[model samples]
Target: MLIGVFAASLAFQAGSAFAESYQGLLKKGYTVGKMSQGKSGSLGWVLTGKDGKQFCKSKVSLAVVDKKTLVSILASGRMVKVDRATFEAGIGGPDPSLPLLSDLKAGRVGPQHVGACTPLRG
Candidate 1:
């Protein structure tokens, strides 16, 4: 019985119930804020690429997963969850904690950077 209860709890916690919607997260600033690649703000934001070209033109937003974790989303239909502590400490950023690479490699990018640049500018 104890084991069953513990497993149930684990499964529940693994899901997005621990996460919040983009706007819902913006409302609660429990160590979370707006992150944008272009002149940071809550809305009217843009995501730029390393080549200085437009990547994702989105109204990106951020939400706190925990005291040290954050979830970032873009209206362009991309999302990435990152570790706020690491990101702020200059260590930075998750994509469901796993990534799938292809046989043919194009560009080399660290897996930690999943979505556009939502640097938690909030």
Candidate 2:
């Protein structure tokens, strides 16, 4: 009985640990380059800072659920779902998404707007 309780506790911890990742905090504009498949077979984008300098030379992958693609930071695996307006504007250009990111960080976003985001390993 004690073992079962301990197992449940461990599972819960693991689940909640990844519930929110550090990626969700990034609000700065990133220039996402062309999409390409990484060596690991994950489809991702090459991101860069607004200055046109190299940001993440490696490809960053996004998880899409129910036609909604999740956005996340490459360094951390935190994720958030933005409206179509936000996504279209932010996906490839310099767009201020601080308010949207803030809403996600504060958990003010509704369940319908929340999606899964996982960082790639490579």
Candidate 3:
């Protein structure tokens, strides 16, 4: 019984460490690059940061209500239900007048957006 408990605790600790690693990647600023379509039409996305660094990326089965909204889970297990307007506004371009989503959907990947995430100053 003690051995089982120790193994379980180790598994939990490893899981937590994995989650922290993904969070650390996000804190470094990663942008969504490619979204792969699933067998059921669901989607998966890949996020890349500046200097070609890979951040947290995920694939999820999504249910779309409107043509403009997507509800899915992030790689970190965070539930994200985003609409076109919100997505566009939230992922604004360097000029704020342009949005990265528009370019992404149009097959154009741009530079990483500044201040996109909490700046890591350590």
Candidate 4:
């Protein structure tokens, strides 16, 4: 019965975590952009959000079996799981080279030449 209790507790915790992560993603305006299946059967997702002025993108890698309850790794090397508050808070920010969400909100980073994600070949 101890094993059963432990399993029940784990399920509850996972459910709570999933809920938090889902809410956070929604609050941060992330929508599913693309999905791909990895070789190991894990799922990969690219999350995209736009402020109507600029775009924010993140990639998440997770297991398909526990898609909802898994944490994803961002391209920025940040580990993000499905906890809405933390994800939202963590995602919508700025970098020194790129315009931050806060700056965009405040009308700081105008619709100008934001740098490209890739460098010019020529």
lDDT for model 3 comes to: 0.43
lDDT of each: 0.39, 0.40, 0.43, 0.36
- For residues 23-109, what per-residue lDDT tens digits would candidate 1 score against the true structure? 333344322212233343222222222322222223225544656666565554345777777765663433344322210012222
Candidate achieving the largest lDDT? 3
Estimate the lDDT of model 4.
0.36
Can you write out model 2's per-residue Cα lDDT over 1-122, one digit (the tens) per residue? 99999999999888655433223323445444443444444333433444332222222323323333446544334345545445657667433332243343333433233333333333
Q: TM per model?
A: 0.24, 0.24, 0.33, 0.22
Q: What's the distance in Å from true for residue 99, model 1?
A: 27
Query: Please, what are the lDDT tens digits per residue for candidate 3 over residues 1-122?
Result: 99999999999887554433334555667555554433333333344565353332232223333547655544344446667566657657222333334343432433332112222222
How many Å off is the CA of 102 in candidate 4? Answer: 23
Off by over 4 Å in 2: 19-23, 27-114
Sorted on lDDT, best first, the list reads 3, 2, 1, 4
Per-candidate clashes, comma-separated: 4, 0, 0, 7
Error (Å) of candidate 3 at residue 59 is: 11
lDDT of 4 by residue, 1-122 (tens): 99999999999887554322322444668554233333333333333344221122222232122312334444443445554344446768322333332332232322241211111111
